[model samples]
Target: MGLVDTLTKSARRSSTTSSEGATMAAGYSAERAPDGNPDDTEVLDKEEGNLVMALISQLRIGMDLTKITLPTFVLEPRSMLERITDFTAHPELIFGAGKIEDPKQRFLHVTSLILAGWHIKPKGVKKPYNPVLGEFFRCTYHYEDGSEGYYVAEQVSHHPPISAFFYVSPRNRVIITGELKPKSKFLGNSVATILEGEDRVRLLDRPEDGEYTITMPNMFARGILFGKMLLELGDFSSVRCPSTNYSCDIEFKTKGWISGGYNAVSGTVKGPGGTAGEIAGHWDQSMEYKDKGGRKQVLFDAATTKVVQKLCLPEAQQEPNESRRLWAGVTRAIKAADMEAATAEKSKIEEAQREKTRAREASGQRHQLRFFEPVGEKYMPNIGVDRQVSGAPLAKQSPDEMARTVKEWLFGEVSTSPSQSVASGTQATPLPPSASVSHFGSETATMASTASMQSLNSVAAVPVHVTAPGPPVDGPKLSIPPPHAH
Candidate 1:
């Protein structure tokens, strides 16, 4: 039978069964779970299969999917702004990276930290909710060593769908700032989310080593129209530090039709002199590093490492624009397996956003961002840091003072009591005309060109001698400017 015919038959078979076991076999039990964690292979129910078929009929081979409204079943019950926290899941790997004396070791530690993050995602082919403009998410991390980390992220732009975020662990002397602009497209039976952005990591204690810029790999959702839906990271990514002249080029290899394996990655670490080492293994399991001397060490093993829990205020305590509070109704409906109610709740948020956009266009007002500010084509944390000051650099600030400043900047006030609720800063303004109600812009559609596809496949061939200021020859180019240029 043809693929569509087989799906239809399966749906008909499922429709005839009234038993709870049959319903679970059709993925009903998984859908009703609060977390909605699916197995590696997701089985769509009759209703879901029909809905997906209808949606697929409307899509072109290489069409941009940013503006398309996806089914609620595919949602992960969290905003993209909050989902970005997955990158910093393992605080143990990142907190002490800067303290490593040797540049090569530090670079390797950073690479391991990057690779470790990809394994913490929710199982199944799921995507986080596209955050609305001006919506924000913030949380705190309490490390085992008694130190704390703070993270804040905001959807600063809507049309291009840019999420700017900041993370700092003052006691650990680490600061990370970055932006994510995800451009999704329908590629035949698969969908790809081109991760267009970079993370700038600064080791406050090791200022002389400078900042490390890390690029991201693109995400691919395979077998969307047939077979079992699966998520894979494809193409090239890199971690580079200019001051130390050290870099690591990583390739997230996708599984081929009849060969290859899922989550496989290979990388080369280069220093100022030449190639320093090589790394190989699966990103979701374990990775190993080998130095020039043939000395090998396990870089990261996901099975042994525990992800630190993040603390967020209760939904009732959160501001109206906070990610959890903003999507509470939709989340509750999804958890209860009420697709109709979920759709209605989701539509309310989307329609409210559209109304705000229309009102802004009519009033000729631009969106006023809360946590981040645009610096040229990039965005930076608006922590009120004065670079013009003669001698006092940001690196010299005490950890307590730095944390206080960041807290005030994010919450609009500094509170000493841990039990006190921190109010979210000023009410958000509507986005500008260019940043419409659409999730992403027209530029995303152009990213599916032949040239980009070729680049994605040839990542291993990229030259190692490239400097931090220059973009890599293979894969998606990083758009972040040089360190401290802002």
Candidate 2:
């Protein structure tokens, strides 16, 4: 049977016996502002009640959230595949590596850049749709400095929901690759999504040089059961350089249950010896660094850091399985504030995926991942434990070669020969522009400034390298730069 015919038959067969209160007659959409940010108004209380009840029925204190089915209305109008671009939001910190001569200082600068990215999140706490298997997202970055970056992410596994991604900056001669496996558990009043993965950044020109291993902090969806829904990050993460045996530990502290602070983080960067330096600040606000006995100075300011806009192929140019194309109808509906259309379209995708799974099972065939390859062991100390990390290798390649590869992947090739279809031959029609769709200008959020200098009570020592004159140029207010570059 044709795709529409199969879906229509399935819908009719299940329409008569649908569960009570399980399906809403219509979906609810949140009000949004001209800048694309959600407005102060809450989603329809009635619709939210239904979803909350469904969640409460299955929610245990420590229940695994990955297994639960959430209503589509609560989802953000984007896929997890596209969300990974947040890592490259601040390319200056990443590409600045070429100028730094000291390996230790370079390590610190890069690590700071990685930690600075968490503040670039959407204003609200809406969840992104879990990408379907073989789903892919690709976008390019064209910076004001005439630098360019390429990013591509693929959902490599479905069972455990693993995502693999790769990024390259030709101007910086830097490359980043990693896999993500998010494990979510429901706390009594909140949900904790522990990011189980390790991302690595390497200087392409220095192939034989060691890579920097970056870790992700765990996230908490606070007040999930009761009270206002708030998003907070907690737990601890680290960045380690195996070759230099240097490592840094960052602790994300959650606010007190009754009264306290939020978005706070403090850490220490040390080598083989004792403490080398200390970093303290709010991840959403600002971070300050102190080298041993040196005076505290600003390292990053989330309040004013400008995020670079990502360049993406228009919806029409994207392949069928690409994230934008596959979710176009749903995204368009969400953007238009048509929650009913969004939910209906989302259901179609999910139903189709279920059918594909059944067919593959009956044929005893397994879905194979394209673009990314599974690695035997990609784990670092506190990163993903034994989880498979899959991605293409960062082979030795000239800048020209890497650029060509990325271009071919984003745009089509010139060869007239036929090739394999993209992502199981699935196709979706594009949705037309609607009045609800708003192109909101970018807005910067000011993180609460709760971190104080008195909190810097750690032991202090003199800074070894003193070549830096001021803070990074990206943020004018930040004054303490890392060691000088070559």
Candidate 3:
């Protein structure tokens, strides 16, 4: 057998083996119970009514897919693959957290929740999966009680969903692998991608309006659009960031492919994007994003896209020249691409609990992010920009000091001159007469500018008071066509 086959066999063996730790980490003992042990019965009681009501209260009109509720403390839905896995690792805890009170009520509630939330769906036209709505539930409850339960809930059969893995360790010590499926009931897609320090990805379709969007679903609020990529976006594409969601313009041709097994049709993206790729024997890849800098580090500073690739190995081809084929058998036996890896089954209750808390409590106070919602340019067609943050204090300086003052705070280029105002009586240089009229309009104007967002026609010494992106010019601006339709 080839290396991939061997690895696959080995991985399968390990999972079935008593020593692989998945079963151990699952942390449940399957002691059989007497037949019809009434003690093991579960139901959805008055207590469960709270869970159902809470779920209904959190009901959003747009999440036409499944809806669920965990405790608190999760800021992003990016780690969903790992979180869902918790089912195997901590069955008891998961069962305990349901708060069903009676075993029969618990079973009914858990089973119904799973049926309502996780039923399988084939990935067909109109794929609507929301990764952000990871309000996951479990149908299979592991309550042995010495008796066998015959009831099985409906299963959610999703068509070829995408998964991405990132061996994310500075020294490769830990691998943060993630898997995602598209939920059609929700407006999401079936794509997944992972990122490291030097990865870039692109989408298959160019936006008709020269704009790309990064979105994050709000668990308690309307899903927010992070940014539109018409302007320079790659400038901020870093692997390690405060958030995992961001979009940017990429320099590349659509319908092209990456020879090193990468997809270049979307483009050679350097920011956070989810496109596609293949992994070792057991997996493949795709790409996407979440909101930026919202407690989830991946969603903050990194680009907002994920890629899904295949996990199976490619067949080896023998060159006509055979002298170099001396170790053909050996090379085929040990290639890294052909090696299969072990997968750990997980239980994701705690994961859900943590996510809910983060969404509810982590906004405004700790992490303030800039979405691309422009107050100045909204009405205009096809203008891409970052969401102008509201109530941001002004640049804190007079017209003469506009450029110098902003540069110092934003870039740390301190003024060499003695005249600098910094909340003190430190006398600043007197404003030149010409500087008074033209200072606010200068390109060097700071966030402190008086430009008012409401009046695009109005110009002042602040960002909110500036004139609009002004009426369309008579001449056409050079722009690229939509990447998707073509």
Candidate 4:
């Protein structure tokens, strides 16, 4: 059977009664559920099995999976723009990290904070909705200490598929700005999403410490063509703070055919003097950190951690281009297990986007961004920074002033005009000339192969000394074309 046909049949079999489905199709609940379950494995049903075989038949060993269309059953009920929030779910870990009297202790807290975010993911081998061009998502966090954090993200570019985001907790003196450029490829029985871009976090009060840069591990969906399907984070990632002269290289180990376990991670914390400590454990369970003197500490225990949920405005109050409101139709259909309706709703959105692109092309006008603007090779928030200065620095504004500025930047003038309400369509510009050969050349393929062969038991046992700083360890580079259409 064809992939869609098999998927439809499977969905029908698993769907609720007609009456229940009809009621659910009327409207999805406004209450947002948590992103994913704690479990990572799913046994394929008969139809899903057929669909997987059909999908594999159409693929090559190293083909890019971006243009390929997948079934609705494999989608998480959220947009990738919102999925980025998972990294910031546990704010308490780094709420006052900058305030620590010792710089080394502060850097350790920051390392733990980065490790805390990876454990929360969707159940099974599900992918989030590829955010349409110009789609945006915003939410607020109300912390226990009565401080509030604001976050906003926009699908800034579509051709190369870039999503830029900004977050700030003024009272907590924390700020984060980053972009994500995920490219997926089929790797035999497994699929890998090479997580590109960097996440920069700055503590406003600790200007001398500089900003910390973090890279993400690539996600692998293993055993897609055979065996039990499971999600794994494979390869290397790093956390570096230049001012503190400290860095942590993390290895998210993949399972081996005969031996290695899932989710195992091990890394060394290095500083100017020498190795400061070592970190080891399962990412989905508990991770431990041992200092040079052999003092062991719990870095993060997923079993005992409580994730703080983000709060969003009502759908009715959100702008037309907001992620939840924009994808509401498809989300409802998917939740109701109505594959036909889901496909139709999803097509409607995609078709509308195509029409917009055509209209922009005809007029020879580029899609104007609403919140972020391209700054050199990266995008930066139009607000929060003092543009009057040569190198834009955070405006010396009070917490209330910053909040007001953010509110205005997000909502803008409180007008009801259609122009003010909706974001523009995809940019008319093509990819930059450098993008074709930028990084991720032949060397990356070799790196990926080398990473896959690494065993979980190979973590180094001895501390290594470092006399000088080296280049920051970032995610593996990979050249990828634009993908994830619907």
- RMSD per prediction, one decimal? 15.8, 15.8, 28.3, 17.7
Clashing pairs in 2: 35-440, 292-461, 293-461, 471-479
The global C-alpha lDDT for each of the candidates, from Candidate 1 onward, is: 0.68, 0.60, 0.20, 0.66
RMSD of 4: 17.7
Best candidate per TM-score, number?
A: 1
Q: What TM-scores do the predictions have?
A: 0.78, 0.73, 0.16, 0.76
* lDDT digits (tens) for residues 1-486 of candidate 2: 543233223323223323221122111111101111133112224456455555555555577889687776667777887777777766655454544455656666677776777775544456788999889887655443333566778888878988888887764578788888998886554568989888888865455556888889998765333333566788888898877777899999877644657788999988877688888888877887787778565556766666655545557666788898899999899889887898899888888888989999999999876566676654221111123222233244444454454555444541211111122333311211121111111211121121221121111221111101111223211222322311
3 against 4, candidate with superior TM-score: 4
- Which window of 10 residues has the lowest lDDT sum in candidate 1? 477-486
Q: How many residue pairs in model 3 have overlapping backbones? A: 128
Which residue ranges in model 4 land beyond 4 Å of their true spot?
1-38, 386-395, 413-486
lDDT string, candidate 1, 1-486, tens digits: 443344334434444444343344334211111111245546566688677767766776678999999999988788888878877776555555565566776676667767877876655688889999989988765443345577899999999899999888776678888999999997654689999999988877688887799999999886454445678899999999999999988999987645677789998999999999888999878888888888777777766656655556566657899998999999999889998899999999999999999999999999999888898877887774435233344457676666556655655554421211223452221111221111011111011112212221222221111111111122111121111100
Instruction: Give the better candidate number (1 or 4) by TM-score.
Output: 1
Per-residue accuracy of model 3 over 1-486 as CA lDDT, tens digit each = 543233223323323333323223223211111111122111222333233334334333345433332212111211233223221221111122122232222222121111111111111111121222212211111111110000000111112222221211111011122223333221111111211112111111111112222211111110010100010001121121112222233211111122222111121222234422111110011222212332110101102111111110011221221111222232333322221110001113334435654775766333221111112312110111112222222222222233232223221222221111112332222221211110111112111222321121121221111010111121111111100100
Backbone clashes, each candidate: 0, 4, 128, 0
Candidate 3 residue runs with Cα over 4 Å from true position:
1-262, 266-486
Could you give me the TM-score of model 1 versus the true structure? Answer: 0.78
Clashing pairs in 4: none
Displacement of residue 420 (Cα, Å) in model 1 is 11
* TM-score of candidate 3 relative to the true fold: 0.16
